[model samples]
Target: SGCDTQTVVNNNGSTEYGLFQINNKIWCRDNHIPHSRDICGISCDKFLDDDLTDDIMCVKKILDNV
Candidate 1:
């Protein structure tokens, strides 16, 4: 029998049960995210996280937490 689980926090400040650890890391699918139009003042999570949405408004949520 194989069993594994952990706690993961989302941008909304919610905890999700994480399982199937891969060398102390959990993998999940990322959604579409939009980046800032201006590259100078753009503060999207693109540099840190992938684009989860094609719209800035949608990405804002992830950016807020991430």
Candidate 2:
């Protein structure tokens, strides 16, 4: 499904944020979650804006690992 930067969804106990719907439990850090890996190395809120630079960078980082 397509989404925008403002998109946020709760799936089971995990929350997905921003256009990529990045999961707080894995990719990005959310204050509410205590043990997130934060692979993106940035606040989850950074993805929730018009600028896609950080979002794209994070995606690239994610792609590199796989």
TM-score winner:
2
- Provide the overall lDDT of each model, using Cα atoms, as 2-decimal numbers: 0.30, 0.80
Q: Write the per-residue lDDT of candidate 2 for residues 1-66, one digit (tens) a residue.
A: 276667466756777777877778778887778799998888888888888899889888888978
C-alpha TM-score for every candidate: 0.22, 0.82
Q: Report RMSD (Å) for each prediction in the order shown.
A: 13.4, 1.6
Clashing pairs in 2: none
* Candidate 1: 10-residue stretch with minimal lDDT: 20-29
Off by over 4 Å in 2: none
Q: lDDT at 62 for candidate 1?
A: 37
Clashes of each: 6, 0
lDDT of 1 by residue, 13-44 (tens): 33333232111111122222222123223332
Decoy 1 TM-score against native:
0.22
TM-score of 2: 0.82
